[model samples]
Target: MAYVLWEFTILGFDPTSFMFSGALIAFSWLLVNNRMMDTEALGRDQLFYATHDPVILMDAAGRFAGANLAARDLFGDEIPEHGGSLRQLNKIGPMLDCLAATGELNPAESISVGDRVYDPRALPIASPIQRRNNLLGWTVSLVDITERERSAEALREALSRAEAANRAKSEFLAVVSHELRTPMTSLKGSLDLMFNGVAGDVSDRMKELLGIARRNSVRLQKLIDDILDLQKLDLNTLNFELQDVEPTEFLREVMRDCEMHAAQAKVRLSVVSDDAEGRMHVDPYRLKQVVGNVLSNAVKFSPEGGNIECSLGATGDALRMSIRDSGPGIPENAEDKVFGRFNQVDSSSTRASGGSGLGMHIAKILIERMGGAISYQSRLGVGSVFHIDIPLAGGVPRQSSPPCDSVPGDGEGVPAFGEVRG
Candidate 1:
């Protein structure tokens, strides 16, 4: 018993119907060709012919044997009753010849025939009359993929444009930060001098006005720095200087560094626990940035006369530093989003919101890059605690990353990177 060739269906066709029709087409081909087909065999042939795509049949020698009605309409006048080779078809002929040579009856690369693109599939069938007829023949279908290809190209173009725009924005922010920072620094310095009677004795009103100006300038400076740092993070240009640091001391220094901010907010800051004993292998400057970011959030949100507690504890080869704030706690299902840039939180009257939103996101990424994790726990009305955990390997260096252009600080307060001396 001779069966029809197995044809593969791709996009634009129902796979089940395609397989069912293909199975029937196998027996239909034998009956139709041998001139013994009934109405059922003719029905199967009609179903294959009615397929939306153009399809053709070729003998083992690459000669055109048959074609569906759709194929006849698509390749009009190119196919005759079966005398020409598949190589005679426009654009597809050479590809079909290559497929025949390699005996690859699978789907190959797409091709453009005339005005549209098509994904082509081939199916090879065995012949019993091998001596007189060809040893094998193929049933090939050309599925139109013009719309899909166009859509893919448009998506790629849009993504390229978006990436270009982001890069331009980063570049613009970098230039603005550099140009504005120097002048802003000088302006703040002048205000500080006037307030301190460097030029002349200042009156109380002048002193107060100068102090306000200094504060606003400081806020702007911080915003600019956050933007610049965020850009560096976007470009993966933020450097790290790994060092051995006592975890408990690190947390204590961060609390001290944040004391002024807490004082300004009228919130008392305290270290609740210092159970972490060993040193951690980490970039102290970057880690400080992370801790400072979380602590800053605590200070900003704490209620007047509220207490902000910092704690460091040991947890099975890892050190956990948590900052708790006595303020309106974060809402439920907000844990993941707290680190998101410009993330929306419970913005009621009790919560005092501040910061550029970039700091938290930058801190999260930086902490994770240093082989650490940042997370939080909160009660709706009680308070919230932000946790930072880093694995401790007993002072062993954990990174093979290239040396950063920064040197470690003397574990003082919240440390800043110093330039590496040549």
Candidate 2:
């Protein structure tokens, strides 16, 4: 075999003898690999310093090694220089200790520097080479969140103001309703006396005029009463006298009371109580108001000659009452808003239907307060069904004490619409 020879210098000193060409080529490849590794390390350092977020590097001994321009601006002259211990730095030392113990990249911690809020995070750096896989320290960063905190504080204040305004409005309505009811009661009585010819015999024209006045006065009185009830509900002062009563007979009586009004609307009212006989513990007068409000709506909305059905049934442990009316169904968009205060399915219908738009809302509130729920299903042009579900008296635990010998009043001493006789 032909002998191969190599010539090289060792650290600027000439070699004493020639070396094999294969050994020379191998040494050249090692130098090239080491140079490439150095270039990669330099590139990584450049990227770390270029980042806009404050980046700080620390040694495994918890001493500061380096920091980017952003870190200098954030910490100002307080930034540790050279191999200074991080424990000596104010505000930053404790945060660094927590990060070191937890080894978390982003901890739920914030630091307030002057008027600014900065969210601090730390990530441990490690050697990339497998053989040198050693802890290199940490890279800490800080993110500003001052604007976010300000926005959150503003939202809290706005909610507080809104709640205060609503309370004030409810109080104003309660006072005004009480003030108006006194005059309305007197006006209604006076008009009724005139219509019944209590003053004197009247001509047909005078009687018709007095009858109109009587009806309008009655409507106004009802509106005022509804407003007062709504105000009481808002203030959480509405009282209930729970009593055990027959559901079928009670529902029949309510239907019967609405018959005269339904007749005037030319709508036929029907009740179907199929095997629904049971005693329900409920406040009878409040129950009546709930049923009456629904029944009245059914009468008002039902087309002439259309039939309105009231159904009562016992399903499982609950008593369910449903009122089905043959009227223009509620629009899809307005369905969810029906139980909102002063909400109406058809705004123009309020005038024709003779309502203050509080009937359904009040009914819902009363039902809910009595531990029940009300919902409805409606199809456009096909009519609607309103359902109330109340747990049977003993089926669910009572939420409050039974009506005492002295019933709690709403401070106004207003008489509710039910007989108190047991």
Candidate 3:
């Protein structure tokens, strides 16, 4: 009977047996939690694998430690399960070259992998696990910039073609100018003889008609001369004699010379200088051309009896000169085009304005050559203002500054010349 009770007791659910069963259940729950954490970590790694940019980790001994999805996709099954293949390393040849040269590579570098050309970069990193040892190595990254490289190459090719075309056009213009000038010169001489009665005297009506013809011929000749001058400037053959010039005196002389033209247009032209006396370091003749072009435009654009203002001042180590005109102002949209060659505003004003359409372009080129800048502003139906800013030389005097003991004198000044040789 005692033995039978003992066997039954062992089979029954006692306190000790219940406690052991509860401990087992707790341990199982802990195991489930641990598995959940591990799954979450694996999911994060998988997410990194799907990115397009190739990522690779290598040890100090150049052994591949790990690779992302992109690296695997590129190498396929060829990449070893442990250390990467030499073929994989050689794939980014250009990237390696850039790294060798610059100690780092950027995404802008050109590279190739397999049959595909890739613009990629390789970045070197110190071993994270053991900095002084080969336990962990560096990480290399690559990005495909093939599209960017293609676009850049295409742009370079297009630029080359455009430059070739521009050179050809410039050559053609220069040849045409030379050919045209020879015949025009002959025509002008013939007209001069006829006008002077060298050929024969003519009746009153005939002479009047002949005078009109001569005037139109003169205007045509002027246009041709402007074209020739523009061509010379383009070809960089415009001979300039450089010298020191007094700004106040130079402005006065330019206004005086342009007085006749301004009077003919019935516009008042004047100069206002910040200093009564100051000198400039430049090619005086070329500077005169720049100023003359501005003055002529101002005079032509100003309404009759309206004010034409030319003001000069100092601006941040530069001499600033502005020519302002009171006329039907420039159209806002067409302002930029005005600086381009042969470009004029499409209006009655531009048509009525007699010019070879090279004045502003030539002026801009000349000013830029002199280490200066020219810009303009205009409002429709109001007025237009053109500003020139030129850097001052070391010896140049300011408004209230003292002058040097030595005053520069004109030596072999620019040759005497008339307007357009008409």
Candidate 4:
């Protein structure tokens, strides 16, 4: 029994047999895990092959590890089988260099890959290694951007055609305005001579009739001027003369000039200033023209015995000017079209308003030219307020006197005949 026990111990302690048994068990486990791994890898490879976009895997040194079937389609059989630089794939050298330098690339940037614009994306793959292992490599995705390129080219062509059409329209309007003004100038000159008694002495009733003709002629001249101004603004040819002017005084003067016209229309005009003294840097004439246009429109649209108020002040960094009128206010749905050329808010009211449907349009252009903006708010019956917003410099009013008036017609501040020519 002692001998049998010793032999059993020897069998149990056999080093060579124990080593062989352990090796066999490890080999079996490895075989099972390898089969499972191969199945997962095969599934990923099949999916990658079926994808339309080109996808590639690379090692840390920028050597290609693998590529999808879509890549094979783009590069044909010329693609290297294994361990080749992505730069060797085609004209992707610069893009590869950029990706390697920047560590990441956005998809919007275009890259050239073998005569085709490719939008490539580079994203890092996380490693299974612990403690935040160094970046092992990246997966690059390539999208054909040729369609985007074609669309952009088409848009550019459309823009060019639109610009050409606008130029043609502006040229036609400019020529017509010049031609119309020539004949109107001659007629106006003849009428002026007759009304001023240069032709002969006329009766009071005849004089009144001539005055009506002359006034209508002047109105026609104003329409032509507004049209020409619109053309200039459209063509970006309006010469800007910027200067510093006192804001309060400027508002006061604009109100003073329009006093007569407002009175004639039986509308009460008032001016409100937020500052006893304030100033701004802008083109004085154009600024006044913008204010005058707004005030005149307010007075014209207001009913008899209605109130028109002009207010000037500063709101934050912007200077604000508002003209409020009491009348049948703007139509709710027509507000957006009010600033468009030839868009009449109230078609039936235009004949009485005596406008060429260009006042607000011209005012908008003038204000924008001076680095300002104008907007309006109106209810159906309460009133309408036209607001002008201009960038402010914020300085004390200068001690300089106001500029002398260059030329004038009626106290309504319409330009004189010679002033209208230019």
lDDT of each: 0.75, 0.74, 0.66, 0.74
**Per-residue CA lDDT of candidate 3, range 68-140, in tens?**
9898898666556676443345555334444444555544655677655665645566545664643344567
- Consecutive 10-residue window with the lowest summed lDDT within model 1: 400-409
Which tens-of-lDDT digit does each residue in 211-275 have in candidate 2? 88887887888889999999899888889988887777888899889999999899998874434
Ten consecutive residues with minimal summed lDDT in candidate 2?
Answer: 401-410
Listed in order, each prediction's TM-score against the native is 0.74, 0.74, 0.64, 0.70
Better of 1 and 3 by lDDT: 1
**Between prediction 2 and prediction 3, which has the larger lDDT?**
2
| Candidate 2: stretches off by over 4 Å | 1-53, 102-107, 130-135, 235-243, 330-334, 349-351, 379-382, 396-422
The positional error of residue 320 in candidate 2, measured at the CA in angstroms, is 1.0
Please list the Cα RMSD from the true structure of every candidate, rounded to 1 decimal place: 14.5, 11.0, 10.1, 10.4
Better of 1 and 4 by TM-score: 1
Which candidate comes out best when scored by lDDT?
Answer: 1
* lDDT per residue as tens, model 1, 291-318: 9988988888778998887777654456
Q: Model 4 over residues 169-283: C-alpha lDDT tens digits?
A: 9989988997899999999999999999999998899899999999899889979988888898888888878876777788889999999889989999877444524567788
Model 4 whole-model lDDT (C-alpha atoms): 0.74
